[model samples]
Target: MGELKLMKGNEVIAEAAIRCGCDGYFGYPITPQSEIMEYLALREPWKETGMVFLQAESEVAAINMIYGGASCGKRVMTTSSSPGMSLMMEGLSYIAGAELPCVIVNIVRGGPGLGTIQPSQADYNQATKGGGHGDYQSIVLAPATVQEMYDFVELSFDLAFKYRIPAIILSDGVIGQMMEKVTLGEFKPRWTAEQIEQMSGSWATTGMKGRKMNVTTSLRLQSEDLEKHNNNLQAKYRTIEKEEVRFDEYMTDDAEYILVAYGSSARICHKTVELAREKGLKVGLLRPITVWPYPTKRLQELAQKAKGMMAVEMSAGQMFIDLKLAVNGKTPVEYYGRMGGMVPSPSEVLGALEKQLIGGANNE
Candidate 1:
């Protein structure tokens, strides 16, 4: 084993980015996510390893800075909260349209115009459906715990670079601030020069006089060409759905009732599973790591074995819709959550599960 340390998820993200040979970080300070920037400033990875950390004037500027760094074939990332993430949507669309490879972490707080400083999963629809104006998709990776924050970031970097697309670590405030024992493996970068070159060769702004400047843009003058570009992006997304769906199964091998959750809520659901187990309830957890790709297939498979699932979240069951779709009316799928930073406790979830398990309440 490398080492074990109790650290917050935000701190681990900064360290992990540096260890992954991140060349730059461009971000605007935001609530519940400021610690990541503060941690990077104190650690000063830039001083030791030439890594650049730039606190931009705003989130828009920050994401554009990410675009600039990525243009140079450098591994770059940014971190912010929900409000800040909203500000970056325009740039996010541009980055996606230009086919750039970069990582963005949104330590989400309550949403819809500065809602709260506490944790929230309200950004699920925005993240999965593309908050920007254009038809774009961000590879959204959700981490359920501080440990997964570290583990998933490494994977996020790989996916971002692999797909020549902007990838997001769609985490929340609780996971960012919570301290947990984390094990980091040997530092190994997911990208090689050849890999970077391949991505850049596809769309990056390398040079001009060489080959008509190789415009990095998402615009096409002809409708047919624009349609072609959109079609290509859609195909890439389909590829991700096939290869990038990730989730965790617990007590699910023989589960009669399944709990569908993601991010920190799913971590809470795990404890709920333990309590349900002692009470002789056949419960299990399906924790989706990629919120956008949404492990619908795996959950559908579980639906075949379980009576139903209760979608858990810090928001008002924002993910329940996906669960219902996966279940396809074959089983009951309900909702259990609190909005504006109110997280359900293990006892609260247990009570809800008990009500459903006994009463068969399908609250839609």
Candidate 2:
């Protein structure tokens, strides 16, 4: 344990980045997530940890900077909101295509186009289903609490490097601005040049030290080569889907009705579970921690036991499609959401559960 401290979710991410021995951070200021860069700038980790913190002129530049650092086999990251993340889609696709390991945090706000600076889960489709122009996938982690926001930073780095792929911390304003007590983890030293060479020298651009130069590019001009690359990427994605599906099942052992959610929506659904339980309803909450891999196996298993399921979210049911596919007509699955920066309260969720799942409205 490093220390126990009260902190906001965004600030915790910054602190954890430094503690995790992150080599570089490049980002533009955005609402609900500006605290990440602000804290890093204030702490000046460069002086103590030899970390490089640079504020890019735009999100476009920031993600490209991450590309540059990650090509050199350095642990790099960036943070942004919904609109800013949109701007980074091109770079994100390139990073995925090149198989660079880096973390990108999106403290999501409501948006189709700069909609609002309030919390939202509308980016579910964008985040999980290739936000960029490629047949690629990024590992997406959704944190429901401040502690998770801190912990996921380290976890994201590890998974990113292990898989040689981009990892995204898909959070929202509700969690980003919320405060909580968190126990920090021990500091891990940054990777040395020798270690980088040993680990990623085959692909990473360390240098031409006694070997051929390493090239990191997403360009595959030839059709046969591009097809081969796509096949390899697809295989990796399948492996990730098999090995990395993570979720938290709350009171689901004998649940009759299940509620599926992630991020802040999961936190709210937890309370809704309690409220429904008090009303003698057998409702459980399935909170997906890894939104990309999506706990589909668990959902399929639960479909066998539960009568039906409900997808609760801060969006207009983006994740509902996955739930429907997971259930596969075995049991009914309905969607209940509050979009455009509106967060559904416990009472509202309970009401929806009663009307949609338990009250025979969806029984037919």
The per-prediction CA RMSD against the true structure, in angstroms, equals: 2.0, 0.8
lDDT of 2 at 215: 95
Error of 2 at 42 (Å): 0.3
Model 2 Cα lDDT, one tens digit per residue, 80-150: 99999999999999999999999999999998898999999999999999899989999999999999999
| Highest lDDT against the true fold, candidate | 2
Task: Rate residue 218 of model 2 by lDDT.
Answer: 99
State how far residue 169 of model 1 sits from its true place (Å): 0.6
Give lDDT tens digits, candidate 1, residues 69-173: 887677899999899988899988888888888899999898679899999999988788888988989899999888788887768778987898888999999
> What's the true lDDT of residue 212 in model 1?
50
Q: Which stretches of candidate 1 lie over 4 Å from their true place?
A: 187-199, 208-212
On a 0 to 100 scale, what is the lDDT of residue 261 in model 1? 87
